[model samples]
Target: MPTYEFFCHRCSKPFEVTCSIAEYGRKIKAVKCTKCGSSKVVRRISAFQVQTAKKS
Candidate 1:
């Protein structure tokens, strides 16, 4: 699962949602805001976490 960052226009707040890429693509309609329950949400460009093994 990847954590996606989103911003709510109605609430003027930011939030995050963890879901699979397939599910995200399947979400044709706009995502609902966690705080204000508004569908006017947009995905935000955020950093991703990368895990690398130590060189032993």
Candidate 2:
């Protein structure tokens, strides 16, 4: 499973959900806004950091 970030249009809030890749690929439309209980949610691009070791 992977974490996905979403933005709620009804409440103007951001949230995250962890689901299987298969479920995401299938485009399951069951995501709901935790704050406003709205189904109008959009996926957001999440930023991640990668650390590299210094060469000795």
The number of clashing residue pairs in each candidate reads 0, 0
lDDT of 1 by residue, 1-56 (tens): 77778899998999988778888876626578989889899887743332222332
lDDT of 2 at 22: 79
Sequence-dependent TM-score of model 1: 0.70
lDDT of 2 by residue, 1-56 (tens): 67778899988999887889878865447888778888899987654411222332
Any residue pairs clashing in model 1, and if so which? none
Error of 2 at 2 (Å): 0.8
> Any idea what lDDT model 2 has?
0.76
Worst ten in a row by lDDT for model 1: 47-56
CA lDDT of each candidate? 0.76, 0.76
